[model samples]
Target: MASNRIRKSALPGFRFSIGFTILYLSLIVLIPLAGLVVKTAGLTFPQFWETVTSQRVLASYRVSLLTALFAALVNVVFGLVVAWVLVRYRFPGKKIIDGLVDIPFALPTAVAGIALTSIYAPNGWIGRLLDPLGIKVSYTPLGITVALIFIGVPFVVRTVQPVLQELEAEMEESAALLGAYRWRTFRKVLLPELVPPLITGFALAFARGIGEYGSVVFISGNMPLKTEITPLLIITKLEQYEYSQATAIALVLLIISFALLLLINTLQRWTNRRLRSA
Candidate 1:
């Protein structure tokens, strides 16, 4: 029966595709991650614990996690607004603005880092205006967060835009006719439909932020125990020939990131189920 089912499959090159997919994932994803695990295995339990828990490493972890969370949160709110405007409104330069939303997707990360730093470097245009008011961006954690926000906005906007476009206008109109206020209608009606995709966008942005490096390093200034991020720390360790420690830190980040993403997925599933029930 199973053989017949396999033979009856219609997808082109099903077996070949499956085999190639697994092989490709192993070569591209599994192998490198396994290498990090294997390298970290060289450390004793105490050594591994000490390496990840060192004050400097801990500070980097805190900075990376917090900045990523803040950036992702910011993206959720503004990305939703941008997606809504792009989908529901027609105005001058709309196409141009929509295209600009994807700048982060196509522009090189180093170029993005340089552009962000140049504009926020205290001597630069916007930075100079804020500089006299005692606001500084470059070489600080706030600067890192700004860079992250810049890179992550596209993830949320792009993810949610399609979902919003597919949602029926009638549903919203019905809610209004039934006496639901705009705010309540959005909260109770549109929001339920959006929750799943929004969560997915949040998770993607968060994941990107956690792994971000080039842009962050330029703005963060890579100060130890201050604005350094985990990825930057990993690079610094690699530069100093501390492969074991680098891998150990990478493993921690991998585990934590996976765990958080899993949590978000769970929340999304639960929200979907509740929405269906309602």
Candidate 2:
């Protein structure tokens, strides 16, 4: 009876489907990553170390990691606020504002760079006002942060927005009945439900910011050891035909990114488990 059930429930051509899935993954993901590893492996340990640890490369790493972290953190705060506002309230031009949230997803990175450059240049409208106060936005590290924030904001907003929309108001009402303050209620009730999505968004934004190029290039001024980013450094290596060096740096970034993402996933799981137990 068990054998008969198994035979009857089997998908037609399951073997072929499974084989194609494996082949497709190999062709699309594994093969390219393998090629990258192979190329990076061509370098000796000292060479790889030197390539990834050059003063310029180290500086780029600092800039990239810090700016990305800053951007992600900024997104976590403001994205939550934006998502909350959108989900809980009605306001003027609400539909237009909702549509605007997706602009980053549709806009080209290079175009974003150009547009930001134009708006934030010293002579530009906003820049002109800030320039007198001794603030520089374009062609600086701050500009890089702004560009990253621009592109990364959507990830956090979109991730948290749906979760916020699905959340019932009854929880807030219950907390209020229990004499909880507004902040306490949100912190205890809403935040736990939002934490998983928030972390996921932060990770996505952080990862994307690490590799961001076009949106940063125009604003960063590409000043090595100053405003340069790791992705730009990688591109420079490739342009100089230092293929092995580029691959080595890329490999290092890949490893670090993977480890960080894994750590985030572990933390998320732990948080979920604790929440469930509570």
TM-score of each: 0.90, 0.90
Task: List where candidate 2 sits over 4 angstroms from the true fold.
Answer: 1-9, 263-278
Among all windows of 10 consecutive residues in model 2, the one with the lowest summed lDDT is 269-278
**Per-residue lDDT of 1-278 in model 2, one digit per residue for the tens?**
99997987676877788899999999999999999998888888999899899999999999999999999999999999998898889999988988898898899999999999988999998889999999998988889999999999888998788778777789889999999999999999999889988988899889889988989999899899999999888889999998888898899889988987897788567655654554
Give residue 126's error in model 2 in angstroms. 1.6
Pairs with steric clashes in candidate 1: none
Q: After superposition, how far is residue 192 of candidate 1 from its true place, in Å?
A: 2.4
The whole-model C-alpha lDDT of candidate 2 against the native structure comes to 0.89
What residue pairs are clashing in model 2?
none
Error of 2 at 11 (Å): 2.9
